[model samples]
Target: MKIEVNMTETKSNDSETITTTQQTSGAKNDSSKGPESIYTVPLLKLIKEAQQQHGLRHGDYQRYRTYCSSRLHRLRKVLHFPQGDRKGFKKREVTLDNLKDEKFVYLPLIQAERAWAYAMQLKQESNTEPRKKFHLVARLRKAVSHTIHLEYICQSPLCDARTKLEAQAYSAWMQGTLFFELQEWKQASEKLVLSQTIYEKLASALNEDEQILYKQRVEELNPNLRYCAYNIGDSSAQQDLLNMRSKGGKSELDALIAQTREKQAASLLEVTWRGRTVPVRLEKIRVFLLAYQGLDASLGKANDCDAKLSAYETILLDCKEAIQSLKEDLAAVAKTKVDLQSSQLGSQQYLLSYLTFLRATLTIDRNLVMVDVFQKNFAAYQSGESKKVAKPQEGVKLYEAMVQLSGELQQLQGMENDKKFQNDLELLTKVFKAFRCYYMALTCQGNRQWAEALALYQRAETYINQSEGKKLGDSEFTKYSRVGQDLAHLRSLVNSGKCAAHAQNILGVEDINAAMSGLSVRSKKVYAAPDLQIWRLAVYKLILYM
Candidate 1:
C-alpha cells in the first residue's frame, strides 16, 4: 500500500520547490512512496495526480496552487525575518513541496497517518466504530507494516494474532475510561481482558508532541504488563516474495491460496460479499490491481513531464550562480585602487560594464540586483568619474560633468530622491543667478524692468535652503549673502543710471534714465520675450563693447 501526499503547485512555488512522481512497473511502486522521491518526477505530474485522486478540476487545482503559493512565499519571508509582525506565518500550511526546507514536514504527516491507522485497527474487533476516507491510511499501512515485519519471524502467526492484540488494546483503553467514570475496576477489567496486547505499542513514529500524548495514554492503562504473549513475526514472508520476483514467479500467489482456503472453510456460499472489510496488508499486486485504472493510464504520460522539469531546475540554478559571480567581480574593482587618474578611469569604465551586466541580469531573468545597485549609487551622490575627467583651466570640465550628470539624473525615471543631483543643482543655480544679475545691471543700468531681473535672482535662492544640509562650509551663510550684494549693486546701478552726480556725480539724471531705459526697451523689442535668456545675451553684448 502507498500513501498520497495531496498538495497544490502554489504550495510548491511558495516553498521554492518542484515535485513530480512516476510509477515503475514490477509488482508496482506505491503512490504513497512519492513524497520523498517527487523531486525526481515532473512538477506537473504530481499536480495532475492530485486532481484525479481528489477529482479536482483545472480551475480548482489552479486556485489551490495559488493559495499554496501565496502561503509558501509569505511564510518563507516571515521565517527569514521572524522579528516582525506577520503572525499569519503561524497558520501557514505544510506540504510535501515545502517540506524539503521546512524543519520537519514528514513527522506531522506520519503522525496523521498513524492516528488514522490506529483508529481503524481498534474498529476491527466488535467494540469500536471504524473511520473511512482518511488521507494517510495508505502511508501508515505501508510504513507500519515495514516496521512490524522487521521485528517478526512468522508472518501468519503474528498476522493472525494481530486482531486479538488490537481487541485487547481497545478493551484496556475503554476499561480504563469506564473505571474513571463509574468507579468500578471489575467492569473495567472485563473490558481490559478484551484488549489484544497487554500493552499497545507507543506511537513513537509520530511527532514529538503526539508521541508525548501517546506515552501518557499507554502508561495510564498498561503499566507492568507484557505486550508479546504470542511471538511477533519476521520478514521471512517478505524475503520469499523478493525471491519469487527474482525467479520470475508470481509473488502474490501464496496470498491467493490462503484467502481461497479460508473462504472454503467458512463456506463461501453463505458469505456476505458486501460486509465491511477489515484493513489488511495486501501484496503490491493486490494494491495495484485494486487501485483505479486511471493511475496506470496517467503513469505513461506523466513520466516524461517529470524528466523535463528536472532539467529546467538545473538550468535555473546555473543562471543564478553565474549572475552572482559577475557582481562579485565588480565589487572587487571598487576596492584597492590607488592612482586616481588610471585607477579611477578604470573604475568608471567598469561601472558602465557593471551597469550593462546588471540590466542584463534584470531583464533577461528579472533578478533585482540592479535595483539595489541603482538606489545605492544614485543616493550616495558620488561622481567617481571625476578622477578620470580631463583636467582643464581650474575645474571647468569638472563643473560641466556635474551639470551633465544633473541633467541625466533628472531624466531618469523614479529618481525623485536623488540627493546628489539636488546638491549640484543648488550650487550651480546660485552661480548662474549671480552672473545673470550682474549682466543685467551692466547692460540695463537704468531699465524699467530691472525689477524682473532682481526677482529672478531672489527666486534662485530657494534651491539654497538645502545647502545648509550638505554642510559645505561654516561661512555658508556669508557665502550666500555675497549673492545679495549683487542685488544691492544692481540697485545702485539703477540709481546712478538716472543721476550723473551718482555716476560721475548725477548731472544729467533724467537723460541717463531715458537713454538706459530706451536701450532696454530696444533690446526687449529685438528679443521678443522679457526674460533672462534675452537679458543675458544683451548684457554679454554690452560687455564685449566695453
Candidate 2:
C-alpha cells in the first residue's frame, strides 16, 4: 500500500539540517556535507570590555543591565531579526538552525548579561526588601538558562574552537554563581575552579596587555574559591585570606567578611603556633580573634587615614581587654596550683604568648600603615606629583615605633629559640633602623642641615648593608624584595642629594667670599694713609672758598 523510498539524512551549510534522499528508481542521488567550522568570535574579550565600559567596572549592575537591553535591541535591529512590533511583543530564539551569521551568537550573550545584571541589581536591593531575594535567584536562574543555550549553539559544527571554549567557561561561571547563591558549596567550587582554570590557560597564551583582563578575572575568582573552600571546611582558607589581604585587595572582599566571621565563629576552635596546638577555651579571646580576621576588610572600607586608624585603635582596645581577661584567668589558674605537665596549663601559657605576639604584631602593623602613608606623601612631594609638604619627621616616629615592636617580638618566649623568627625579626630591626635614619636625613635635608643629613645618610647605608648581608631563602627574599628595592632606590636618592647639597654649599661659600672681598677693598681704600695729600688739597680748596 506504500511506495518503497530510500532516504538519506545529511547536513548542509545553507540550511539548519538539510536532508538528501535517494531512491532506487530515481534517476540520480544527492548527498550534503556539514557546515565548515570557520566562524571565530572573541566572545569573552568583547563582552568583558563592553561590560567594563558600560557599568560593571564601577559595580553598577542596574546601569549595565540597561546597557545590555539597548545593545540587544540594536543587534536585533541590525540583523533584521526583530521578533515583533513595539506594541505587540513576541519571543524569538537563536539556534544553530536559525543562525546565519557569526554576530547571531551575541543574542544569547546579551540575554544572559541582562539577566545576570538584573540579579546583581536585585542583590543590592535585597537587603532592604528581603522578598527581592526570590527575584534575584529567579533572575540568576534565567541567566544560567541563557548561558546553557549559548553553549549549545556554540557546540555546532559552524563554531570555532575559541568560541566553544569561551562558551563553556562562561556557562560554568554562570552555573557557579547560581550555585554559590544557593549555598551549594561543593558544586559552586567545582564549576568556579573549572572557569578559573580555563581563564588561566587563556591568560598564559595572551600578550601582556591582553592577558591583564583574563588574569584579573582569575583573581576575582580567588575570593569566591576561598569562601567556598571555607564553607566546605578547608583548613587553608584562612591562610588564603591573609595572603590576599597582604596584597592590598581587601576592599573587594567587604561582602565576604560578615558571612566569613559568622561561619568562623563556630568553625575556629583552636590556635596553632610554633608547631603546637592550643584550644581556644575563652569566648572573649575567640571573639577577639574573629574580629581580627576582619581587620583588612574593615579598614579597607574606611574613607580616609584617620578612619582606618580609628578602626585599628578600636581593635587594639579589644586586644587589650582580651589580654586583661586572659591574665585574670591565668592568675586564677595559678592559685589552683595547676600542674605544668597538664595540657590545659600549657595551652593557657601558649595562648598568652600567642596573644602577646598578636598584640605586638598589630601595633607594628598600625605603625607601619602610618609609615606607609607618610612615605607616600614624601615620595609624591619628591617626585613633584603632589603639592603637599613632605613630613619625614612623622615617618621617623613611626619607624621608631616599629623598631620597638620588633624588639618586643624578638623577646617572645617561643620566638627566642625560633631561628627563622629571630632572623626575620633581626632583618626587620635593621630595615626599620635604616628607614629611621633615612627619614631623619630627609628631615635634616629639609632644614638645610647638610652635614647632619649627610651623616644620617651614611648611617642608613650602614644599616641597609647589615640587613642585606644575612642570607634568605627564596620565599623570604621575595617577601623582603620590595623594601630592598626601596632601600636601593633610597641609596640613589641619597647620592644625588649629597651631590646637590655639596654644590649648594660651595655656591654659598663663593657668594659670601665675593661679598666680603668687595667690602674689604672699599674699607682699605677709605682708610689708606696715601689719601692725606688729597685731604690737604681739599682743605686748601675749602680755605679759598671761605
Candidate 3:
C-alpha cells in the first residue's frame, strides 16, 4: 500500500487544501530482493498499548503529545539519529538503509502520534478560535505524511505481513480522520471503510485477548463512517447510528457516544426504575441515570468480589456527583422562588430518594463483599498456610456495617412500601446476622470460651439455614450458596467444640487445674487455701463416727 499527498488551492476555511490518495492493492517494493530478514514490529499493538499507557486512555491529547515527544527524543538519542543541534534545524528522513532495527520503525510512528495529538489538542480549541483550524489541518497533514512514510518503510521484505498490514491500516485511518474533519464525505467514507475492513480482518484472525484493540478501533470508526455516509446522502445512516448506539459496550468511546446522543435528545427525560417512570429534568442527572444502566453489565464482567466492588465504587462516585449537581439545581430554583407544581416537586424528591436508596444498597453490597474477603482471609489463616492474618473481630465489624447499611437502605423514603426491596433487605439482614454470629463464635473460641463459642456457632447455623430456605434471586443465590459452604464448615467445628466442652464438664479436674494455672501464687493462696475450722469439724465428726 502507498499513499500520495497532493496540495491544492481551495477557498474553504481559508486554509491550504490537502488531498490524500492511496494505492490499496499491491505495494510495489522497488528495493532489491534483499535478505529475507525476520525483522518485525507489531505496529497496531504497540501504538494502542502506548496510547493506553499515555493520556489517550482518558482523552487528554496534550498529555499524550508530550509523552510522544519525549519518547521520540529518547529513541533518537539511543539510535544516534538526532535531527539537528540547537543552532540550525536539519530534517532527518528515515530510509530503507537506516531500518536496521525494529526500533527504527518507532521513530515515524511516534512522530505521527505526536503530530496527531497536537492536531486533536488544536481541534478542541478550534471551536473558540477559528484560526486554529488552519494549524489543526497542518498538523494532521504532517501526521498523514509520517504515516505514509511509515507504511512505505514497512513494505520492505524485512518486515512481516502483520507489520505491513497494520501500517497500511494506520495510514488509512489517519487519512480518513483528516478527510472526516474536512467534511470530504466521499473521501472520508472510502478511507474509513478500507481501514474498518482491514481491522475487522485482523481481529477475526487473532485470539480473543488480541482482538480487543482491533475490534475497539472498528467500533470507534463506526460513528465517523455513519456521519460521513449521512453527509454523502445515505438513507440508512440514521438507522445505522441508532443501532450502534443500542449495541453499546463499556468502552470509553461508547460512553462518550451515548452521552453525546443523550444530551442531543434532551426531551427524552424520563427514567424508569422498578416499574415506575420518574421525570429526571436535570440533564446531568438524566445522563448519569442512562450510564448507570450499564452498571450491572460492568459488574457482571468482573470475575471476582474485589473487581465488582471496585466497579461499584466508580459508579457510586458518579452517583454522588449527580446527586450533588441535582441538589445545586434545586437550591437555585428554591432561591428564585419559582413555585414548582406539587407533582413535579414530588417527582424530583422521589428521584432524590431513589438515588439515595441506590447508593445505600450498593454500599451494603460493598460491605458484604468486604465481609466475604475478611472471612476468607481469616479462614485461610485458620487453615495455617496463608501468611496474611485477618482476625475474626474484623469480620464481625464488617458484618455489623452491612447490617446497618441494609437497614438504612430499607428505611429510605422511596423504599417504605417496596415489597421486593424490603424482602431483599430482610434476607440480607439475616445473612449479615449469620456471618456476624459465625465471626463472633470464632472470637469466643479464640478466647477459650468453648461453651459460648458452641452456642454462637449453633445460632449461626440456624440463621444460615433460615436464609437458605428463603426464595433467592440469582445474585442472592450466589451469595447464599457461599454462605452455605461456610456454615457447613462451621458445623463441624461447632460439633468438635461441643464435644470438648462436654468432656471438660465431665472431667472437671482438668478444667480446675487449667483455670488455677492461669492465676498468680498470691491469688491461689487467697482463693484456694483450705479453711482450718471446716477441716477440724470434718476430722472430729469422722473420729466420732469411727
Clashes of 3: 0
lDDT of 2 by residue, 89-159 (tens): 78889977766667789999999999999999999999899999999999999999999999999997667
Candidate 2, 262: how far from true, in Å? 3.2
Q: Count clashes in each candidate, considering only residues at least 3 apart in sequence or on different chains.
A: 27, 0, 0
Q: Which stretches of candidate 1 lie above 4 Å from their native place?
A: 1-405, 413-546
- The positional error of residue 52 in candidate 3, measured at the CA in angstroms, is 12
TM-score of each: 0.15, 0.52, 0.55
List the candidate 2 regions with Cα displacement exceeding 4 Å: 1-37, 205-209, 266-288, 291-546
Encode model 1's per-residue lDDT on 437-525: one tens digit a residue: 33343334234344443443343333333222343232312333443334444444434433321232222344456556666643743
Q: Candidate 3, residues 1-546: lDDT per residue as tens digits?
A: 222223344555422212101111112242222222445687888988898899888889999999999999999998889998989879998898766667889999999999999999998899799999999999999999999999999998668888888999999999998997787989999999999999999999889998998998897888887767766788677445534543444453454455454744476578666667788787767666755666676666677987777777866886898889878877887898767455333666678877876677667667767877876787789899798978889978888887887788778776677677678678777877887887787788778776677678778768867776565463423444555456556656656655554343333454477567768955654344347435644665567459
Once fitted onto the true fold, the runs of candidate 3 whose alpha carbons sit more than 4 angstroms away are 1-115, 123-170, 179-268, 274-276, 295-307, 338-345, 366-381, 384-390, 414-427, 449-546
Per TM-score, the best of the predicted structures is 3
